[model samples]
Target: MNKKQKKMLIRIAITAVMLIALAFLPLTGIWRLLAYVAAYLVIGYDILRKAGIGIIHGRAFDECFLMAIATLGAFFLAVWTKSGDYVEGISVMLFYQIGELFQSYAVGKSRRNISALMDIRPDYANIEKDGKLEQVDPDEVAVGSIIVVQPGEKVPLDGVVVSGNSTLNTSALTGESLPRDVAEGNEIISGCINMSGVLKIRTTKAFGESTVSKILDLVENASSRKSRSEAFISRFARIYTPAVCIGAVLLGVAVPLLRMAFGADAQWVDWVYRALTFLVVSCPCALVISIPLSFFAGIGGASKEGILIKGSNYLEALAATKVVVFDKTGTLTQGVFEVTAVHHNELDADKVLEYAALAECASSHPISKSLQKAYGKPIDRSRVTNVEEISGHGITATVDGHSVAAGNAKLMKKLGIEYHDCHCVGTIIHMAVDGAYAGHIVISDIVKPHSAEAIARLKKSGVSKTVMLTGDARRVAEQVAGELGVDEVRSELLPGDKVAEVEKLLAEKSPKTNLAFVGDGINDAPVLTRADIGIAMGAMGSDAAIEAADVVLMDDDPLQIAKAIRISRKCIGIVRQNIVFSLIVKFACLALTAAGITNMWAAIFADVGVMILAVLNAIRALRVHNL
Candidate 1:
């Protein structure tokens, strides 16, 4: 409990003891009045003071007003007896204080829950210095410093492997209830636990610049951005509180006068009691507090799982998404290239590889990198010269007096080199020696293991269709789309072609159906921005991609797409439940209160009862993962 909560609990205990003593003692007149004063001072002095301040500020109608009227009425009731019903006055204040304590306790519990989620933010990082571990503030730790992370410790900074390896339990940040494997060259985000092994991670980003830091910053500010449901409750409370107070005042003055004017014997005291009870039931404090609390818990829960939803507006849009479009490379397939096969004529495969490496050394295409990697040999660089690039085609470079051309079939066709043995699944880069057929290297990218599951999960989340768009040829695109269970495939697209395809999908969207686009790192920035919800895959390493996408999956696992949709569905469901529950109960209680059928005491039950139920429901947002 916080300092404020501890103090409230202390006061509650004192009031409870006083109540017990008052019930047992048989004191007379002023002695009994002094007891009532003690009990009221212990429990409700602050409330009385608040009422007085509200009166001075010209905002005197609220819960404080209700408490003041109820307690003071009981004091006047004490005048009927020897003690002015001082015991009843104190007891009512005591019960009201008990309810306040319960609310404070609940608020403290919810704050603790969220604070536990934010535990991912570490206080310091251990920078390796001359083989000794030195502790420093995360912000003070410079980039390129090697931070040592041991088991059960959070990765305090974002970094790459300098040495050692481990499995990271990222439940605190990514909400994936699984531990991830990390090794040399693997990148790690801040806030994940080093479940095992001692890691010497070379920090790629400073503390404030890390993924966890940015996420913490986003979540900390989420409450300031209100959802539609929260806004409604705020406006309702504003109008409802003052209106109910006005009704209560008119009831106290007009109803007794009406009876007296009609020559009836209606007492002012009895009508005043009813008016005080009406004021107690009209606070509207509960709805105002819990509505925003629900969304706060929801977004906090999502942040715990490594999904950064920019705002609640995105959460709402994500819940309504019906069509999900995906970028082929990086988004679905492992964006890394590998040599799947080698086809060569008039030379052995090794000789073909050696020559291709020399020619491609002058270029920096992904396929060239794969070729150089496959060759497993270093390029002399001196053997290569006069490198020239062909737009959308290939590169021409002279190596050891031999003219080498490396590009797609476009260059092969343009050079009039006849090679018809090209396969459909992998990228085929043709090579020409002085404009003649030399050989071709086939590079294929493997699909991510999570892509298929991600697709299946999206289908479960009410997504009607999954589409893949890529700049790769139709054959490669078809091969990937088939493996990943994509419903539609648009391939052989340039950057413009991808944009046009997104426009087409937008046109096809229904009034009720929303469309989402997922993409490779930052290259699909334009398309990611165009979709209803732009989810960027592999959010951990690329700051550019993370900024462009509305929702970022820190680990770049496509399966998180489904998880995000599921979270949105759950959050939106909870939001709807609260709204429906509040409105139905509020309308019924208000009707019964306005009608003379239900008494003022019953009105208190209806108002306070509904507030308690709504608050309990709002707390469900914190436990969303269990749901």
Candidate 2:
């Protein structure tokens, strides 16, 4: 417990002991009243003070005002009747304080959970000066400067490893417990801990633009964007509190006057006591506190699992998503292209690939990179001469004093050379050596290991439709779609066409459901903004996509998409349950109290008991690991 909660606990204990002792003693009227008043002031002084301040500030229609009025009215009724029964008023305030203390403790526990998730903030960066290492603020390091990260130190900035190799612990950033291995020339992000060896890094971004900083900014501002349910509760409490207060006054005066008009005894004391009971039963504390707490705990829990939801509003929307749209490259498939086959070669397969890799060595295209990767050897550019790059076709060069050509079918047709067309679902690169038809190599992007399973999980989680949007060829797109079990496929689309497709899907779906678009490229930014919810892969995704997205998957796993939806559905379910349960109990108690069927003790349960149960249910949103 925090210091304030500790103090409140002490006060509650003292008040309970005093009330019990006064009940046992045989004191007379004045002494008994003074003892109960002393106990009431000890437990409820702050509540009375806050009610007085609200009245002075013209905001008297709050829970504090209701509580203060009810307890004070009960005390006045007891003294006027000379009943010496002050226990009812003191017990009401005592139980209310107990509920407030429980709320404080719950909120504190949630803050601690969020604080643990935010422990990735680095304290310092190690920079070399005068042949010695000096620790400085991470903000002071400039881009392109070299920073040293020793064993068990956090990488303070986004950079590329210039020297040494190490195993990095990325649990704080990705929520995965496995350590990632890094070597020279590998790109490393901030907020990862170096677990094995010393690493020298060349900084690529400053501290403010690092991944840790952006995530922290998103989490800190999440509460400002409230969900629809929270806003409704706020409006309801504003109107509900004052209306109940007025009803209590009418019951106190109107009922007694009606009795006097009927030529019966007024029984003013009995009627006024029922009014006080009604006020106590009608306080809206349960609905006001539990709804927002559920959302806050849900966000905190999701952060621990590497899902960064920008706001509670987005979380609510994600739970209602029935349509999921995906971008093919870097989302459902590994974006890197690889050489899959070599056929129809006059020389050896390795020989054809070597010539092609050498011919395309001067270019930096993705296809050329794939050929070079397949070659698995360093190229000597001096061996090639008379190089010519044919536009819309291929490259022609002399490799080791032999004519070498590498292109597609159009290039062979232009050269008047007969070539065999291979039937394959990939990008085909035909090769020609010395004006003779050589083998063609096939390059294709491999699908991710978990992409198909992710689609299945989404379907099981209540998603009705799944679509894949791609700028790739129709053949390749359809092949991937078939493998992934997507319900729809839109192929050979530009960025603008993707937006149009999303708009069409938006119009086609039911109005009550939502559509989410997922992508990981710079061109996907516009479509990401156009969809109902934008999910971006943060690890290798472009900066523009992340900026426009509503949800970010830190580990770039498609499986997290389903898990996020499940977490949100659980949270909204708890919110609805609390709203229904609190309202049912509150209205039921109000009816019994006004009819004089229950007393102040029952009103205490109607307010404090229900609030305590609702708060306990809200805390369940913080446990989401198994989900």
Candidate 3:
């Protein structure tokens, strides 16, 4: 614990013991009053000091001031009436102290949530110097510099793999709850754990500019951006605190005057005493504090699961997200290309794949590697020469003095080759030797198995529209889109075209409706930025998408995107409940107090009772993991 927190606990314990001693002791007169004074000071010293400071700063009245006056009024009345009831007044201060401690505990718990999320931050970064390992600040590490990450260490920054490979636990960044395989030339993001195998990462972003740091910054500042409900509480407290103070004053003065004018015998002391009680009951501390506390806890809980919501306003909006649009390839599918099928006529399947692999050996495209992987044998790079790459089609060249070709239909057609038709739903690559059609090899990007379930959960979570946008051909995009049960499909879109589609959806939104776009995080950055809510699959997401998105899903799972929305919906629901519940009780209690049907004791119950209830309710935000 911090020094201040420890000190407060010590003071609170001493005050509790002293108050009990005063009540139980046989000592009377000076000693008993002195004990009462000690109890008051122990439990209320902070309140008194704060009230004094607030007064000096020209804020005439505050919760602290109201509390001090009300408790003192109880003490004076006890003295006037010759009753041993000063304990009631002092107990108010004691309970106020307990309440303060309770608040501190709750705040500390929420702060711990933020700390735990940031525990993913790495303490050291490895740098290579003269063939030796050197430790340095991540900030001093430049892009393209090689950094070594050991097993079980948090990735210090975003980078591409230059050497080695590992299974990275990206649960902290994306809520995927799984370890992903990383290899040479693969991109790795910050805030993920290097689960196994050592890796040499070529840094692509500075320490401060990394995805993890940006997430930390956003989560830290989320509470400062108040939701509409929270803002209302602030305005309500400002109006209510002062208005109650004025009412208390008028009650203490006007009642006595009215009795005197009527020549009726009435105890002015009783009325003034009650007025002080009214002020204590109307402090508004609980309403002002607990409402925001709920949202703070909610945001904290989301952060723990690798969902970084930018602000309470966005959190509230997420609960209301009606339509969710997703990009197909990197978002719903395993972005890594894999050879799914091999088709060949007049030749063996392995040979067709071997020729295709040789044709694409020198090219760096994912499809090339996919076909190369299907061969499952090392290529004779010596024979694979004259590798001519044709843009917008495929790769071509003379391999072993044979005119080998492999690519989409466009490429085969360009070579004046006749390609056989195929029924499979995928990219059809045709091969030919010396201008004669050999056969066609079909390759498809398979969807992630979890995509269907992810969509199902979004429906359960209250999303009405589930749309998919992709640059893939209509047949390919639709084939995958159908399996996922997507509500709508828009295929064959460039990055600019995706932005235009997002704008069109936004324009078509009903009042109070919001649109969210999920993407591979690079090509879809503009659309992510343009939507009502930009949610990036940060892990496997492009750097540009991470910057533009308001909410980040660290592990590149479509399931977490839906999970995040549910979390936001739950948080916003709690916020609404607290707002309506607190206001109803507050307005009811204040009306009763004004009518004088409620006594000072009743006012205290009304105030303290409402606070304890609200506090318990606010802590519900921490239970988001269970939800």
Best model number under lDDT: 2
TM-score for candidate 1: 0.86
Q: What is the lDDT of residue 216 in candidate 2?
A: 80
Q: Identify the runs in model 2 with alpha carbons over 4 angstroms from their true place.
A: 25-31, 539-542
User: Please, what are the lDDT tens digits per residue for candidate 1 over residues 1-627?
Assistant: 778767978887898888788878987778878887888898888999999999999877667876787678667755754435565566666666666766666666666766766898997788767888788888988898878998888898998988898899887765667788999999888988898999989998988788878777766766666666777776776687788777876777788889999999867766666666666666665676566666666666676667777777787788899999999888898899998877877767886677778878866778789989999988999998888888998888888888888778898888788875676478887777776787788889978988898898888878999999988878888888888789999988998787789899989889776789998647888888888889988766577666787787776788878878888877778778877876677666655555555655565666567667777877776675643
Backbone Cα, N, C clashes tallied per candidate = 8, 0, 4
TM-scores, all models, native as reference: 0.86, 0.96, 0.92
RMSD of model 1 against the true structure = 3.8
Cα displacement (angstroms), candidate 2, residue 57, comes to 2.7
Higher-TM-score candidate among 1 and 3?
Answer: 3
Among residues 3 or more apart in sequence or in different chains, the pairs in candidate 3 whose N, CA or C atoms overlap within 3 Å are 173-554, 174-554, 174-555, 521-542
Q: Model 3 segments beyond 4 Å from truth?
A: 1-3, 24-35, 80-84, 126-135, 142-148, 160-167, 181-187, 194-202, 540-542, 597-599
Worst lDDT 10-window in candidate 3: 538-547
Question: What tens-digit string does per-residue lDDT give for candidate 3 at 1-627?
Answer: 667778888887887787777777886666666778778887787788988998899885778889988888888887777776667877787777767777778888888987888887778899878988888888888888999998988899999999998998877665557678999989888888998999999998998888777777777778788888788877887777889888888878888788888998667787787688778778787778787888898888888887778788878878789999998887898777777777666777787788888988887788888888888999899887788888888878777788888877888778888888788888788887656677877778878878999999999888889999988889888888789999999999987888888888888878697898887777776787788888887444356765777777766667887878878877777777777777788778777776677766777777777777788888888777756
For candidate 2, report its TM-score: 0.96
Model 1: which ten-residue window has the lowest total lDDT? 80-89
**What TM-score does structure 3 among the candidates reach?**
0.92
Q: Flag clash pairs in model 1.
A: 78-84, 78-85, 79-84, 173-306, 174-305, 174-306, 175-305, 538-556
